[model samples]
Target: MQLVVGRIGRPHGLRGDVSVEVRTDEPEKRFVAGAAVATDPASAGPLLIESLRWHSGTLLVRFEGVNDRNRAEELRGTMLVIDSADIPPSEDPDEFHDHQLIGLAVLTPDGERVGEVSDVLHQGQDLLVVRRGKTDVYVPFVKALVPIVDLDKGILVVDGPAGLLDPDAIV
Candidate 1:
Protein backbone atom coordinates (compact mmCIF):
# COMPACT_ATOMS: atom_id res chain seq x y z
CA MET A 1 0.00 0.00 0.00
CA GLN A 2 1.76 3.11 -1.20
CA LEU A 3 0.81 6.63 -0.02
CA VAL A 4 1.59 10.02 -1.53
CA VAL A 5 3.66 12.18 0.85
CA GLY A 6 4.39 15.31 -1.12
CA ARG A 7 5.06 16.88 -4.52
CA ILE A 8 8.21 18.70 -5.67
CA GLY A 9 7.35 22.38 -6.05
CA ARG A 10 10.47 24.06 -7.43
CA PRO A 11 14.26 24.10 -7.24
CA HIS A 12 15.18 26.08 -4.15
CA GLY A 13 18.93 26.79 -4.18
CA LEU A 14 22.13 26.30 -6.17
CA ARG A 15 22.40 23.02 -4.24
CA GLY A 16 20.11 20.12 -5.04
CA ASP A 17 17.48 21.13 -2.44
CA VAL A 18 13.94 21.53 -3.82
CA SER A 19 10.76 22.95 -2.32
CA VAL A 20 7.88 20.55 -1.75
CA GLU A 21 4.14 20.80 -1.05
CA VAL A 22 3.65 18.31 1.77
CA ARG A 23 0.52 16.14 1.71
CA THR A 24 1.20 13.88 4.68
CA ASP A 25 0.54 14.59 8.35
CA GLU A 26 3.84 13.30 9.66
CA PRO A 27 6.64 14.92 7.69
CA GLU A 28 9.43 14.27 10.22
CA LYS A 29 8.85 10.54 9.89
CA ARG A 30 8.26 10.58 6.12
CA PHE A 31 10.94 13.05 4.90
CA VAL A 32 13.94 11.85 6.85
CA ALA A 33 17.36 11.49 5.31
CA GLY A 34 18.29 8.05 3.91
CA ALA A 35 14.62 7.24 3.23
CA ALA A 36 13.89 6.17 -0.34
CA VAL A 37 10.62 7.28 -2.00
CA ALA A 38 9.23 6.33 -5.38
CA THR A 39 8.01 8.88 -7.93
CA ASP A 40 4.91 9.11 -10.07
CA PRO A 41 6.26 8.84 -13.65
CA ALA A 42 8.41 6.02 -12.20
CA SER A 43 11.48 7.45 -13.92
CA ALA A 44 12.46 10.38 -11.62
CA GLY A 45 12.95 8.03 -8.70
CA PRO A 46 12.95 6.03 -6.42
CA LEU A 47 14.53 9.17 -4.88
CA LEU A 48 16.68 8.85 -1.81
CA ILE A 49 16.24 11.57 0.82
CA GLU A 50 19.75 12.98 1.12
CA SER A 51 18.72 15.80 3.49
CA LEU A 52 15.62 17.50 4.84
CA ARG A 53 14.70 21.00 6.01
CA TRP A 54 11.68 23.22 6.57
CA HIS A 55 11.14 26.74 5.24
CA SER A 56 7.94 28.36 6.53
CA GLY A 57 5.22 25.71 5.99
CA THR A 58 6.89 24.04 3.02
CA LEU A 59 9.37 21.16 3.04
CA LEU A 60 12.81 21.26 1.40
CA VAL A 61 14.61 18.07 0.44
CA ARG A 62 17.80 17.09 -1.36
CA PHE A 63 18.26 13.80 -3.08
CA GLU A 64 21.46 11.87 -3.70
CA GLY A 65 22.88 12.30 -7.25
CA VAL A 66 20.62 15.32 -7.74
CA ASN A 67 23.36 17.65 -6.50
CA ASP A 68 22.63 20.73 -8.63
CA ARG A 69 19.73 23.15 -8.99
CA ASN A 70 19.41 22.37 -12.70
CA ARG A 71 19.14 18.68 -11.88
CA ALA A 72 16.51 19.41 -9.26
CA GLU A 73 14.57 21.66 -11.63
CA GLU A 74 13.85 18.65 -13.81
CA LEU A 75 12.03 17.02 -10.86
CA ARG A 76 9.37 19.72 -10.42
CA GLY A 77 5.86 18.22 -10.15
CA THR A 78 7.34 14.86 -9.08
CA MET A 79 5.27 13.08 -6.39
CA LEU A 80 6.91 11.46 -3.37
CA VAL A 81 5.50 8.22 -2.06
CA ILE A 82 6.18 5.67 0.69
CA ASP A 83 5.01 2.18 1.47
CA SER A 84 2.44 1.39 4.22
CA ALA A 85 5.25 -0.22 6.24
CA ASP A 86 6.87 3.20 6.59
CA ILE A 87 3.71 4.73 8.07
CA PRO A 88 1.76 3.92 11.20
CA PRO A 89 -1.96 3.21 11.06
CA SER A 90 -4.44 5.67 12.54
CA GLU A 91 -4.96 5.10 16.28
CA ASP A 92 -8.69 5.71 16.05
CA PRO A 93 -10.62 2.72 14.75
CA ASP A 94 -13.21 4.90 13.02
CA GLU A 95 -10.51 6.87 11.25
CA PHE A 96 -9.43 5.52 7.86
CA HIS A 97 -7.09 5.80 4.95
CA ASP A 98 -8.12 8.20 2.21
CA HIS A 99 -8.39 5.27 -0.14
CA GLN A 100 -10.74 3.47 2.22
CA LEU A 101 -12.97 6.49 2.78
CA ILE A 102 -13.23 7.24 -0.92
CA GLY A 103 -16.00 5.45 -2.84
CA LEU A 104 -18.03 4.54 0.23
CA ALA A 105 -21.80 5.03 0.09
CA VAL A 106 -23.03 8.13 1.95
CA LEU A 107 -26.25 7.68 3.88
CA THR A 108 -28.33 9.16 6.71
CA PRO A 109 -28.40 7.51 10.13
CA ASP A 110 -31.59 5.66 9.16
CA GLY A 111 -29.91 4.38 5.96
CA GLU A 112 -31.33 6.97 3.59
CA ARG A 113 -28.95 6.95 0.62
CA VAL A 114 -27.31 10.31 -0.05
CA GLY A 115 -24.61 9.52 -2.56
CA GLU A 116 -21.26 7.87 -3.13
CA VAL A 117 -18.09 9.43 -1.82
CA SER A 118 -16.11 10.47 -4.89
CA ASP A 119 -13.12 11.89 -3.07
CA VAL A 120 -11.69 13.02 0.29
CA LEU A 121 -10.23 16.50 0.07
CA HIS A 122 -7.92 17.51 2.90
CA GLN A 123 -6.48 20.88 3.78
CA GLY A 124 -6.56 21.64 7.52
CA GLN A 125 -9.53 19.27 7.78
CA ASP A 126 -11.00 16.54 5.60
CA LEU A 127 -14.10 16.98 3.44
CA LEU A 128 -15.96 14.18 1.70
CA VAL A 129 -16.85 14.99 -1.91
CA VAL A 130 -20.03 13.09 -2.68
CA ARG A 131 -21.63 12.58 -6.08
CA ARG A 132 -25.42 12.76 -5.68
CA GLY A 133 -27.53 12.50 -8.82
CA LYS A 134 -26.31 15.29 -11.16
CA THR A 135 -24.70 17.37 -8.38
CA ASP A 136 -21.83 17.15 -5.89
CA VAL A 137 -22.01 17.61 -2.12
CA TYR A 138 -19.22 18.61 0.22
CA VAL A 139 -19.63 17.23 3.71
CA PRO A 140 -17.23 17.94 6.54
CA PHE A 141 -15.56 14.79 7.77
CA VAL A 142 -15.99 15.46 11.47
CA LYS A 143 -16.89 13.00 14.17
CA ALA A 144 -20.08 14.86 15.05
CA LEU A 145 -21.36 14.92 11.46
CA VAL A 146 -19.89 11.67 10.22
CA PRO A 147 -20.40 9.56 13.35
CA ILE A 148 -20.38 6.18 11.73
CA VAL A 149 -18.25 4.49 9.07
CA ASP A 150 -19.15 0.90 8.36
CA LEU A 151 -16.51 0.03 5.80
CA ASP A 152 -17.43 -3.64 5.85
CA LYS A 153 -20.98 -2.60 4.89
CA GLY A 154 -19.69 0.14 2.56
CA ILE A 155 -21.57 2.97 4.27
CA LEU A 156 -20.95 6.41 5.80
CA VAL A 157 -23.60 7.84 8.13
CA VAL A 158 -23.95 11.60 7.88
CA ASP A 159 -25.93 13.58 10.53
CA GLY A 160 -25.21 17.09 9.35
CA PRO A 161 -27.51 20.12 9.48
CA ALA A 162 -30.30 20.63 6.99
CA GLY A 163 -29.32 21.85 3.53
CA LEU A 164 -25.84 20.27 3.80
CA LEU A 165 -26.62 17.42 1.41
CA ASP A 166 -29.29 19.22 -0.55
CA PRO A 167 -27.91 20.40 -3.91
CA ASP A 168 -30.43 23.24 -4.25
CA ALA A 169 -29.85 24.33 -0.66
CA ILE A 170 -26.05 24.14 -0.86
CA VAL A 171 -25.52 25.51 -4.34
Candidate 2:
Protein backbone atom coordinates (compact mmCIF):
# COMPACT_ATOMS: atom_id res chain seq x y z
CA MET A 1 0.00 0.00 0.00
CA GLN A 2 1.33 3.39 -1.06
CA LEU A 3 0.30 6.40 1.00
CA VAL A 4 0.46 9.95 -0.32
CA VAL A 5 2.31 12.24 2.08
CA GLY A 6 2.35 15.47 0.17
CA ARG A 7 1.89 17.15 -3.20
CA ILE A 8 4.50 19.31 -4.91
CA GLY A 9 3.26 22.83 -5.30
CA ARG A 10 4.83 25.70 -7.31
CA PRO A 11 8.52 26.48 -7.05
CA HIS A 12 9.15 28.46 -3.91
CA GLY A 13 12.21 30.47 -4.90
CA LEU A 14 15.03 30.61 -7.46
CA ARG A 15 16.64 27.62 -5.78
CA GLY A 16 15.32 24.08 -6.18
CA ASP A 17 12.90 24.60 -3.27
CA VAL A 18 9.24 23.80 -3.93
CA SER A 19 6.22 24.38 -1.71
CA VAL A 20 4.60 21.22 -0.43
CA GLU A 21 0.98 20.68 0.55
CA VAL A 22 1.32 18.24 3.43
CA ARG A 23 -1.23 15.39 3.61
CA THR A 24 0.17 13.41 6.51
CA ASP A 25 -0.08 14.30 10.20
CA GLU A 26 3.58 13.60 10.85
CA PRO A 27 5.31 15.91 8.41
CA GLU A 28 8.63 15.97 10.32
CA LYS A 29 8.83 12.19 10.25
CA ARG A 30 7.83 11.73 6.62
CA PHE A 31 9.54 14.78 5.02
CA VAL A 32 12.97 14.47 6.55
CA ALA A 33 16.15 15.65 4.94
CA GLY A 34 17.83 12.83 2.95
CA ALA A 35 14.61 10.80 2.69
CA ALA A 36 13.73 9.46 -0.74
CA VAL A 37 10.02 9.53 -1.55
CA ALA A 38 8.40 7.98 -4.60
CA THR A 39 6.37 10.10 -6.95
CA ASP A 40 3.01 9.38 -8.48
CA PRO A 41 4.09 9.93 -12.11
CA ALA A 42 6.95 7.40 -11.54
CA SER A 43 9.19 9.35 -13.92
CA ALA A 44 9.42 12.39 -11.63
CA GLY A 45 11.08 10.53 -8.76
CA PRO A 46 12.14 8.69 -6.25
CA LEU A 47 13.04 12.21 -5.20
CA LEU A 48 15.71 12.55 -2.57
CA ILE A 49 14.91 15.21 -0.01
CA GLU A 50 18.00 17.39 0.20
CA SER A 51 16.49 19.70 2.82
CA LEU A 52 13.22 20.97 4.22
CA ARG A 53 12.20 24.15 6.03
CA TRP A 54 9.07 25.93 7.22
CA HIS A 55 8.56 29.22 5.43
CA SER A 56 5.72 31.36 6.83
CA GLY A 57 3.97 28.14 7.95
CA THR A 58 4.26 26.47 4.50
CA LEU A 59 6.51 23.48 4.08
CA LEU A 60 9.28 24.11 1.53
CA VAL A 61 11.32 21.20 0.21
CA ARG A 62 14.41 20.94 -1.97
CA PHE A 63 15.22 17.76 -3.83
CA GLU A 64 18.65 16.43 -4.66
CA GLY A 65 19.82 17.04 -8.28
CA VAL A 66 17.18 19.76 -8.61
CA ASN A 67 19.24 22.99 -8.43
CA ASP A 68 17.06 25.59 -10.06
CA ARG A 69 13.52 26.95 -10.15
CA ASN A 70 12.88 25.44 -13.57
CA ARG A 71 13.74 21.99 -12.30
CA ALA A 72 11.59 22.42 -9.22
CA GLU A 73 8.67 23.65 -11.33
CA GLU A 74 8.88 20.41 -13.30
CA LEU A 75 7.92 18.55 -10.12
CA ARG A 76 4.76 20.61 -9.60
CA GLY A 77 1.63 18.58 -8.83
CA THR A 78 3.72 15.45 -8.20
CA MET A 79 2.35 13.31 -5.40
CA LEU A 80 4.95 12.31 -2.84
CA VAL A 81 4.38 8.81 -1.49
CA ILE A 82 5.87 6.16 0.75
CA ASP A 83 5.12 2.53 1.46
CA SER A 84 2.36 2.02 4.03
CA ALA A 85 4.50 -0.62 5.72
CA ASP A 86 6.86 2.17 6.80
CA ILE A 87 4.08 3.74 8.92
CA PRO A 88 3.81 2.39 12.43
CA PRO A 89 0.45 1.89 14.10
CA SER A 90 -0.74 4.82 16.18
CA GLU A 91 -0.84 4.40 19.93
CA ASP A 92 -3.82 6.75 20.22
CA PRO A 93 -7.14 4.96 19.87
CA ASP A 94 -8.73 8.05 18.30
CA GLU A 95 -6.16 8.18 15.52
CA PHE A 96 -7.00 6.29 12.34
CA HIS A 97 -5.39 5.86 8.96
CA ASP A 98 -7.48 6.65 5.93
CA HIS A 99 -7.31 3.03 4.82
CA GLN A 100 -8.67 1.85 8.16
CA LEU A 101 -11.60 4.26 8.03
CA ILE A 102 -12.49 3.55 4.42
CA GLY A 103 -14.91 0.67 3.77
CA LEU A 104 -16.26 0.83 7.31
CA ALA A 105 -20.01 0.88 7.83
CA VAL A 106 -21.49 4.27 8.78
CA LEU A 107 -24.48 4.41 11.10
CA THR A 108 -26.55 6.99 12.96
CA PRO A 109 -26.78 7.33 16.75
CA ASP A 110 -30.01 5.28 16.77
CA GLY A 111 -28.31 2.52 14.75
CA GLU A 112 -29.87 3.40 11.41
CA ARG A 113 -27.47 2.59 8.54
CA VAL A 114 -26.33 5.77 6.86
CA GLY A 115 -23.84 4.38 4.37
CA GLU A 116 -20.27 3.15 4.01
CA VAL A 117 -17.14 5.25 4.27
CA SER A 118 -15.91 5.50 0.71
CA ASP A 119 -13.08 7.95 1.29
CA VAL A 120 -11.44 10.30 3.78
CA LEU A 121 -10.73 13.82 2.59
CA HIS A 122 -8.05 15.81 4.41
CA GLN A 123 -8.64 19.39 3.48
CA GLY A 124 -8.68 22.23 6.06
CA GLN A 125 -11.17 20.00 7.88
CA ASP A 126 -11.19 16.22 7.77
CA LEU A 127 -14.28 14.80 6.11
CA LEU A 128 -15.58 11.28 5.62
CA VAL A 129 -17.23 10.65 2.30
CA VAL A 130 -20.08 8.27 3.06
CA ARG A 131 -21.72 6.61 0.08
CA ARG A 132 -25.48 6.42 0.65
CA GLY A 133 -27.20 4.93 -2.37
CA LYS A 134 -26.71 7.53 -5.14
CA THR A 135 -25.52 10.32 -2.83
CA ASP A 136 -22.20 10.87 -1.16
CA VAL A 137 -22.54 12.69 2.15
CA TYR A 138 -19.57 14.69 3.38
CA VAL A 139 -19.58 14.16 7.14
CA PRO A 140 -17.22 16.30 9.14
CA PHE A 141 -14.97 13.95 11.07
CA VAL A 142 -15.24 15.61 14.48
CA LYS A 143 -15.79 14.22 17.94
CA ALA A 144 -19.20 15.89 18.11
CA LEU A 145 -20.38 14.49 14.78
CA VAL A 146 -18.53 11.16 14.75
CA PRO A 147 -18.44 10.11 18.39
CA ILE A 148 -17.89 6.44 17.79
CA VAL A 149 -15.41 4.45 15.73
CA ASP A 150 -15.65 0.74 16.51
CA LEU A 151 -12.90 -0.71 14.30
CA ASP A 152 -13.39 -4.15 15.82
CA LYS A 153 -16.98 -4.07 14.59
CA GLY A 154 -15.99 -2.19 11.39
CA ILE A 155 -18.54 0.51 12.04
CA LEU A 156 -18.57 4.25 12.84
CA VAL A 157 -21.49 6.21 14.18
CA VAL A 158 -22.26 9.67 12.82
CA ASP A 159 -24.12 12.11 15.09
CA GLY A 160 -24.45 14.84 12.49
CA PRO A 161 -27.00 17.65 12.55
CA ALA A 162 -30.31 17.03 10.78
CA GLY A 163 -29.37 18.20 7.27
CA LEU A 164 -25.74 17.27 7.48
CA LEU A 165 -26.25 13.68 6.32
CA ASP A 166 -29.43 14.11 4.31
CA PRO A 167 -28.68 15.02 0.71
CA ASP A 168 -32.31 15.02 -0.34
CA ALA A 169 -33.32 17.36 2.52
CA ILE A 170 -34.32 20.80 1.23
CA VAL A 171 -32.17 23.60 2.55
What do the candidate models score in CA lDDT, each in turn? 0.87, 0.91
Model 2: colliding residue pairs = none
- C-alpha TM-scores of all predictions: 0.88, 0.85
Residue lDDT tens for model 1, 1-171: 677879998998899899999877677877889988899878899999899888886788999999999999999999888776755668989778776777799999888998999878787788889999988888989999999998899998999888889988943
TM-score of 1: 0.88
Candidates in order: C-alpha RMSD to true structure: 2.1, 2.2
Tens-place lDDT per residue, model 2, 33-122, is 988999998899999999999999999999999999999999999999988887788899999988789899999899998899998998
Q: Give the residue spans of candidate 2 off by over 4 A.
A: 122-125
